[model samples]
Target: MLVVLVHLLFYSCVLSKVYKLQLTHKAKHIHQHKHHKRQNSASLINAQDFDFYVNVTVGNGQVFSLIVDTGSSDMFVRGPGCVSNSGDNSCECDNMLPNPTACVLNTFDSSLSNLSQTAYVQYGSANVNFNIFSGPVLFDGFQITNFPFGSAYQISGLGNSGDGILGLGFNSISRVAWATGKDASIFDALGLTGRQQIFGTYLSNFDFQHFVNDVVGGEITIGGIDNTKFTGPITYVPLISESYWKFNISTLTFSFGGSQPLYLGSSGGGNAISDTGTGQIYLDNSLADRVNSFLGGVYSNVYGSYVVDCKWQNSKIPMIFTLYGVKYSLSSSSYIIPYNGVCLSGISRNGADGHTAFSNFGQVWGRSYYTIYDKFNGRIGFAKAV
Candidate 1:
């Protein structure tokens, strides 16, 4: 972990700061954009599986909405002179921000601030290349000075998720850094450590009736955990890796119609990461095939996902994930999503690397349960969200 401590004396006093911000889940249908051209054609388009974002004000009170992602650790926004792959100069910003018109119309000027460095990051199907600059950042009412962030000059495949991203993962994964080779995340730069290194997420389930009216749901607390968002005892699991919120799982099984439970192989056990950036659960191909076979799900070349029988939408089948001796069950209603009158499995095949990734779509597990990411101790906690 790279830690950069810049001491600034204001009236001969040092500052220690903590902050809390509410996150809202923006659930809406996907719209075609210039950036979408860079993403995979098979990417989930009809599903409501984007990330949650919080309002943040960067330098000079220029506010921007940023996705609060635990899977990545870096912060960036489009800057002046940004152009699309097709050489289009107009970068259409998402309307979710505080002032979309102002944000889209204006850009960050590096001439007025200290140029710290330059960076490039690869996220989802997007590549973000930007200039690093240090300035004041405000979250809620807390303010941090000389905070390093990226001013994107080039980007792709961001979709309409959010204006930018607020990476809450480990600082080691941060792409913004000084030329001297030291890297520090936004949290580290703000000096949030020790017991204050805790944060919680409460994501809301998708409601079909009032789609446009209910886009704002869920909450994210920084610097401390929100006890009110969860119930029952929190089950804390140690992190297996520092890169992402990687953790261990004992077993995975599924039960259907009161039938015998089928045990999926444990080959990819203890090697899973909880990611808020992605929309669905990605398991190793072998495990994914087994689950799909049992669910009568077939790979659709049109959607690039497994489509199961729509009748199973109300089935009693439950997918269970046992972690740290605690069994978390995801009801059929939670794992199966309805798209275009067809039912699609929330579970997807992992990459060739064979690592399992539990994402926000699978976070139907979190919908019924609250999740906590403890950066101080490098652990994750879960409790009933009710």
Candidate 2:
């Protein structure tokens, strides 16, 4: 079963001042869902891990959990009768285990909302047709009024894990089309208006000994970076592109037992993008093959991943990535995931679409560093996480 969980991120226009906001961490879980309701009773596998989300109150008092995405630029929630409105009247909602409450949260009421407009978005095989409505969105003690969001009337390919997405990216890629013009992202609506235009993320390591369901230790700061979560001076890298949090990785290498390091070739030295929504790292097929060869990995048709010897899980292999002259290292424990008594390489082959994406630095690189996305400065900062 090969499950590809799609996650997103975003970039916003520049802002004026700097402000600070505290963030809360949302834990991840693996769940099974039926692929087709009537046709096939087989399960659709989800390869990606659950993303980080935050709780926010919408409308009068409708509280829902939404994924904090940096690769996308629209926010929406599942509305009542969404499945019926999905063009294909025969389509039914996937049976989500534990009955995700986030999926069934109060749907946006256009009549009750201050403003309403039509909108649409496509995410990870899910096409959402919705209505954009303005309401007061409350996070912590801060409140923003007339905040634009989507009430999904038609949706497909979305998992039941999260109610919707909170896009932190630029408005250029926003799918929300207002009656008059484009819709501003929540970050742009808040951060560009005399408030701080920066946010930080820290995804904690998952400890097996103290494993707990629905519990995560990571956090995201809205207005500013958290000084307490990181140590040492932060290294800033200029953004190569504002499409995503895109940057350049100068070098990539893998070293085993302190021997000579093998240079990992990334097309054009790798045009990398950082995303909090995606799990695992996706490399070009050539690069992926190189990594698998170095780790003595064998392709598993069952999992569609390169399975390595379980002994490698405890080995001292290290993968290093250099960005902006700064080197970040990932140990064996960071790049290898233990599954079914075997260890699987975290690096996977990118699609053949010809777009080179060093995907999902989270869990591995993110767990080791505190990352800050500075939209105002058009740069990304990293520091050793505490």
Candidate 3:
């Protein structure tokens, strides 16, 4: 026919120049992923609750319920087959309390130390015990020496709130897998006073309505994060590759009136974890019951509570998140949870057997909100809330 119509017009001009170079490289990769999620949402970190403190060396008084953890560091107490609520028994020895005469005997005499006195144990049910104590260890006045800790060696009663767990996580070399020995941390003796660095924490002996005041100490400042007890401008998130402490949340979508009931890892794959001890915000019990039946199924199991019912008014509520590619538009009060002012609804699917025993790939963006794990200058920030 005329050389087959000039070989079909030269293969339709080479498939329209490879479809305009794949639509200009996918619109410049969605404008460089919205300019790296607005430059990592400006390194967020609005941390406070009186900065933080919980350095209690060996079961102090009769009160306990501490939990300011960054994922595990060291500072322990809970010995004596713990299982209390005042009925079961075993936890009220205070290592044999007497009367603040500078209460001593925080023993661990594994032969003074060549190394090795292990016996660790931890993870929520809280039956503490795991040691290594060297000490001048005073905290509020800032004193530390070979203090690798965790003790409550089986005391179960403080089961609910807190009593010990202030590791301000970041893998400081060793003695943390719940920690048990080889002593040395407090930023490893701040390099014998040349002052290497100090700043690590998770303060909250109680307040956010958890209420257990005398404020029971809470802190973790190794290098930074004490900006005069938090006012604003401190949003940072970066830490998930020193091999592992944990925090890789690059995706975990969830929407309501605007549609996407639940999406995870998006088109490419999966990853979602923030876990500040995961009080709530775990999806995938069938997308958390289809987003609580698309928001009309109201909810409230009490573990940090979530109610729902703003009526989905203007609709378009979003929850899009993408870490490495950087995108976070989590509106709707960053996933709503108000109370007397009445906006209650924070999305929950009752942790289907705890996300089927830790994700085979389902969903979990837990800790409702308040996820800012800053590392500083090098880069790691994730902001949310006013």
Candidate 3: residue 136 Cα off by (Å): 15
lDDT of 2 by residue, 191-253 (tens): 343236677777665554454343434666655566766899899888886667877665655
lDDT of 2: 0.56
In order of appearance, the predictions have TM-scores of 0.78, 0.76, 0.30
Candidate 3 lDDT for residue 243: 17
Lowest summed lDDT across 10 adjacent residues in model 3 is found at 26-35
Worst 10 residues of 1 by lDDT: 34-43
Question: Residue 199 of candidate 3: its Cα lDDT?
Answer: 33
Give the CA lDDT, 0 to 100, for residue 6 in model 3.
4
